[model samples]
Target: MAHRLLVCRIWTLSAKEIRCLPASSTAIASTSFSTSLQPSSSQVSFLSPSHGLPRSFTHTTRRQVSFNVQDNEDFTERVINSQLPVLIDFHAQWCGPCKILGPRLEKAVAKQKGRVAMAKVDIDDHTDLAIEYGVSAVPTVIAMRGGDVVDHFVGIKDDDELDSFVSKVIGK
Candidate 1:
C-alpha cells in the first residue's frame, strides 16, 4: 500500500502526461511500475480502473533537469533561445564545491516543473563560454530569461537556499 502511494506521488511529480486505456485481464492480475534516472529516458507505469498495461507500452519522457552544453551552437539553441527561463551552471570537473552544488541545484530546478531549465557548462571544456560569461571561479550559476542575465550566485548553496534562488530566478 505504501509502495503504491509512493509510486503515485512520484508519478504526479514526474509525469508529463497520463493516458488511460482499457485494462486487460492479465494486467489486472499484477501491478507494476518502472522508474529510471537516465538522461535519455525515464518512465513510470500505473494501472487505472479502465486502463491496463499494454504489452508494448510507450515510455514517457521526464522533464530533463540537467542539460550538458555541447558547444557554442548547442548552447545558443538550448540556452539562449530557450522560451523558458534558464539556469546556466558554469563549473569545472575538479571543483569540489561544484560537485556538491550540482545535484542540489538540479533538485531545485526540478521542483520548478517546466518553468525553468538548467544548462551545465564545463569551464575547462568550454573556455570561450566561461570567459565570455566572466566565470573566473568554479560553481558559478547564472540565471537568464529571454537571453539576458537575471540572477546568479557562486560557490555552494544549501538546499533551501537553492530553492529560494531558483524561485527568485523564475520570479516566483
Candidate 2:
C-alpha cells in the first residue's frame, strides 16, 4: 500500500485551488492571496483616436515581462541558482508601492537581459522566500551572486541609482 498527500487553496476574487494526483508537487498557501491566473495575452494597445493609424490599424509594441530565474529554492533551480548574477524582486500585487516600482524594475531587467537574470517572487505566495530574505515589506529588491545575496534595494528605487548599483556589484 502507498500513501498520498494533497493540498488546496482558494481566495477571494480568485479561482478555486485544487491539488490533484499522487502529490508529485505541493503548494503551501493561505487564504489572503489573489492570483492573476489568466493566460498571458501578448497584445497591449496604447492608441489614441487623433494620432493613430486611421480608425483601425492601431497597435503598440507588446512587451513581455520577464524576470530572470535561478535555482535558489527561494526562487527556483532555473532562477536564483543561475551562474550569472541575478536580481530578485520580492513584491505583492496588492501593495501600492509595488505598482509604482514595477515598471522601473522591468526596464532594468530589459536593459540587462542577457547579462543578468531577473526573478520576481510574489511575497503573498512565496512566503518562504520572503522569510528567507527577511523581507518585512513589499517591493523588496535584491541582487544575488553565486547563490548568496550581494546587495539589495528596498522601497522605491531611482533608475540612475539602480544602474550604478548594478554595475558596481557586477564589476562592470
Candidate 3:
C-alpha cells in the first residue's frame, strides 16, 4: 500500500542529508558473509556534534527550555485545551530527523515569545497519543487551534520553512 511505503520512507535517511553532517573517517571491520566482492574491513565514521556527547554533559548548562508532555492526560489538558495555539512535535528518541527538527521548532516557538506554545511528545513513550493524531513517523509537527488540528508537516524542514510554518500557525 502507498501508506505503508510512506511510513517506511520516513525512517530512511537520504545520502544528501547524511552528507550534511561532518564526519571523520575510521576503519571498521566488515561483518558481511559474501564471497564474490568483499573487503575484510571498511572505513567508516560519522559525527553528529550532539550525538557524540553525553546527554547530561549537554544539558548541564542549557536552560530548562523544553515543553515535553508528560503523558496522555497532560497532552489532553495542555495541548487540546490550551488558549494559545499549540505546536505539537511528535518525535522518537531513535529518529534522526527528530533530532534535526527539535531545536529548530523550539527556536521558532521562542521567537513567538508566548504568542504560541509548543509541546513535545516522544512517540515511544506516548504511542496512544501518536496513534490518536495519526502520526506514522517521527518529527511530525501538528498545529492546533481551539482544540482542532489546523496545520501540520512531516520531515526536517529548514529554518526558513520552520519560521514560516510557525508564523502561519500563529497567524502572524
lDDT, model 1: 0.80
Ranking by TM-score: 1, 3, 2
Q: List the residue pairs that clash in candidate 3.
A: none
* C-alpha RMSD values across all candidates: 13.3, 19.5, 16.9
Q: Pick the candidate with the highest TM-score.
A: 1
Residue-level lDDT of model 1, residues 1-172, one tens digit each, is 8767755544554222333323442243224443345332433344443444334557999878889999999999999999989999998889999989999999999998889999999999999999999998889999998899998898999999999999998883
By lDDT, who's the top model here? Answer: 1
> Model 2: runs farther than 4 Å from truth?
1-65, 68-74
- Tell me how candidate 2 scores on lDDT: 0.62
- Choose 1 or 2, whichever is better by lDDT: 1
lDDT tens readout by residue for model 2, 1-172: 1121212222111222222312222222211121345333432211212332223346897555455333355465745567878778888879998888777777766676567766778887777778988999988888888878888878987888777766765763
In model 1, the Cα lDDT at residue 13 comes to 43
TM-score of the candidate numbered 1? 0.65
Tens digit of per-residue lDDT, candidate 3, span 1-172: 6545633442254545444533321111112112335443432223233333212324455443458999878888999999999999999999998999999999988887778989999999989888999998778999999899999998999999999999999893
Q: Clash pairs of candidate 1?
A: 23-52
Model 3 worst lDDT run, 10 consecutive residues: 25-34
